[model samples]
Target: MSSPPAHPALSCAGLAFAWPDGTPVLDGLNLAVGPGRTGLVGRNGSGKSTLLKLLAGELAPTAGTVRAAGGVGHLPQDAALDTRLRVDEALGVAGTRAALHAIESGDVREEHFAAVGDDWDVEERARATLDRLGLDRIGLDRTTGEVSGGECVLLRLAALLLARPAVLLLDEPTNNLDRHARRRLYAAVDAWPGVLVVASHDRELLERVDRVAELRGGELTWYGGPYSAYEEAVAAEQEAAERTVRAAGSDVRRQRRELAEAQARLAKRRRYGEKQAANKVVPPIVAGGLKRAAQVSAGRHRAVHAERLDRARERLEEAVEAVRDDDAIRVELPHTAVPPGRDVLLLRDLELRHGARIDGEFEVRGPERIALVGRNGSGKSTLLRTIAGEVEPRAGEAAARVPLRFLPQRLDVLDDGLTVVENVARFAPGATPNRVRARLARFLFRGAEADRPAGTLSGGERFRATLAALLLAEPAPQLLMLDEPTNNLDAASVRSLVQALEGYEGALLVAGHDVPFLEAIGITRTLDMDALTSPRGAT
Candidate 1:
């Protein structure tokens, strides 16, 4: 297919901003976004959300300006509707409020009517948009207060789509949504004919965009394709940079060696001159010439040493660049020598319920790396929790071999007020402070970081802290149950976690949507919770 046309819908020219405390966020940043889907990526605290706010006109830049041609619709990170309003009421207010204001201003002319396109019919259009977003089955008169967080997000998305603004900006839109809801959101954006900009850390969502823009070191680098293509290009660049650094280092080393050899020869000649002077057998003129020659040789050695040092410094910088560009932080998990029994886990007629009806039932046996596959609200998490003894089954029963550890999806078991050392010590009481700190270091929480409170740590750090605590326990659990372990981890961290899991000999029950992660960890079996609930032989 031909490349999409670059019809600039949003432009930032020489943008600069800083906080009240004089902390610089964006400096001399420039960006242009065209119509169609574009992905915005950045690490935590990289100003992705700030840029989005600037584009949406929600924040004023300290310098320069942002220009957009038409109305901008922004999906805020936390969008909550009033509990008093029904779904239909919320949509109606969002879609027609602008037109209502214009009419109240007594500016309702033929042009205004034409611009709004029959404001009286906006409710019908709003309903249609909501239906397209899979909200049609829901009652419009239903209060938003009764809906779930995921549902509230969907309703807000539907409201934005119904407005049909010229530009749409979404910031971490899928952070709280389920897999099925996320897929639906992606479909809605794909079908929209307007300009779309999404800021997210979700690789799967980024892969659906037409292009990927990464914010690093206060600058944006645009890649012409999706996440996969961007990753390949970055990897190649890193490899080439590494090669250059290696060559430069080799040259520096050779120069240093030559300098050292010249110094050695000059030293030997100086000693011979001293011996001649001691014997009083050399002429004055010849002695002076020899001294001058030694001085010149020493100067040459000094100059060579300076040059080599400079070159080595430059090469070291190049190596640092290569390392920074490559996300390769490897985390090695300390595996315990625990042998699981033959019956790792057994679930007989495992039935669970959300309301009155049974959601699922199944039988699972030992040595089976079975995946619980189902859409959101299909009771996948419930099944895992039931197996972990966190939830009671409405019917049937579950049995597991001794020693089990459950990593809940929320990571709520971690005490936020305590330091990493304290948390690990709690889990492993006999472990000394030094041992706890050492274990935390393995997970990249080194030095003073190990003393930082868990509440202050980032999402990735919190997850690592939890994992470190689990591993340090005296007798490790043979059956490990993880609920969406990869949700908040970065790409590099996720790879490290997968590597650790691959080496694990214990039975694992993981509930996640990352297909590559599941494959990497060697999931050998598959079970559909939704299928389990259905009548036998329904498939």
Candidate 2:
């Protein structure tokens, strides 16, 4: 035997949790994570984040127990930092560092010695951790406010690493990170010596994981390999499920045919008996006895065939349950197409209100799909807003010849008080309710889901509704601009977005940091603000 299986680094038994408002999220779920990187994946609101929270002890379970072999460290989705806290304090070594400094200055207090106990090189270790995460330029004395959001995320991860916890849980750690910062985090995940569970939709990051744990429908499932392996496994499972359904369907048909044949035979026998009795070939008493016997036999034969049919139907139902029926977004915008080589937008030496300047002229012709990429605070959103006419340029002129729409990062296009259909109606005022609902169904909001208030939808649902509102607008949007469209979306929503955009024939300008999403959308060119403003030190 292979030396008895090692104990799980993290374990949870009968893990149940419900909100104070009585909405159950995890219902008596159980999971165990061994040492290595495990990417946790699921649809939005499927409790991937919630289970991480529970495992980290950030939220107490409504029932059951969670146990960690050693210490547990968590990096939440928001990664909040105290702006006034210094880097040393953020790294949780300020106290020991101060004590060591005091001792070096010849203060021999017992408390100082106690605080600096065995680890005399805390600052050096902290610096090494920071350097590994690409924060070598940052000074330990500097305040948190001095760093960008992406750097802050790295800083928080650095703190967790410096602690050397046995178990680490990170939730959507790459949400606001740029490509460079993401690579640094990926390196850390690669070198982790203990259990690391990350809940994310980032395919690149997930590919580095040793395994995958999927949380869905209040239950947990373990896949033995990375994201691609999980995808393959699920695909194989679905194929087999479909095959079972086909076989079950065939069995049901065969059973039904057999029942029909049995009934036909019974009818023929009855006709023969009636003819015999009518022709007076047998005694009346004998005919009555034979008729009763035949009736009893027919009832038993029908019951047996019906029971077999019912069993076959039950098998079919089980097979159907095993097959997933996820719907895809299918919106069509034929009117949004632009003629070849037509000028859709023109920017002439414009200086954006947010301090990013386009010194040279920029033109978007026909249906060119351009990606605006840059580090945070480099004015990507400002450029999109200026193009959308939401912000006035500080200098030159920006013009749009075709109808355009802008979907901000906040997804503020919809009215919170209105239903999804009503929100679509806001953009397409001339369309009837039936027509609006018909279009909404393409966005996967069929039937009563179209009646849900915009404010009550989940993150993914809200994004879909906002997209529907913009795409369904009157005159169609030929020049569509989106700011960080995949910021908080789940994997399914991101796939849906790509599918929707694939069918769009309009000129597109999207400003975001998701490289995978940009590639999936088939971007024809990329505009790097850092390169454009390198002479002015914008980077």
lDDT of 1 by residue, 1-539 (tens): 12334658888889998755455779999888888789888764467877888889987899988988899999866566798988877675543545655776997766556546666666577677767766676676678765545567788888788767999999777754667778888888778798899987787788889888888889888887888888887788778777888877787787778778877887887898888877777887888887888898789777877788787878868676765552433555445334433666666555664521233433334434566555544566676778788888887777776577877665666797887788889999998888888777777777866777766554556678888887777677777788777765667778888888877766778776677888888997766545564434112
Q: Write the per-residue lDDT of candidate 2 for residues 288-353, one digit (tens) a residue.
A: 999999999999999999999999999999999889876556646546788879999997888876
**Which regions of candidate 2 fall more than 4 Å away from where they truly are?**
1-6, 19-22, 78-124, 138-149, 330-357, 374-405, 408-462, 465-478, 487-493, 512-520, 534-539
Candidate 2 worst ten-residue window by lDDT: 530-539
Task: Give RMSD to native, each candidate.
Answer: 6.3, 4.7
Overlapping backbone residue pairs in candidate 1 total 0
Clashing pairs in 2: none
Q: What's the lDDT for all of these models?
A: 0.73, 0.83
Q: Which candidate is the best by lDDT?
A: 2
- After superposition, the stretches of candidate 1 with alpha carbons farther than 4 Å from their true spots are 1-36, 42-123, 141-156, 163-167, 171-183, 192-195, 200-204, 217-219, 268-282, 325-363, 386-403, 410-431, 448-462, 469-475, 534-539
lDDT over C-alpha atoms for residue 513 of model 1: 67
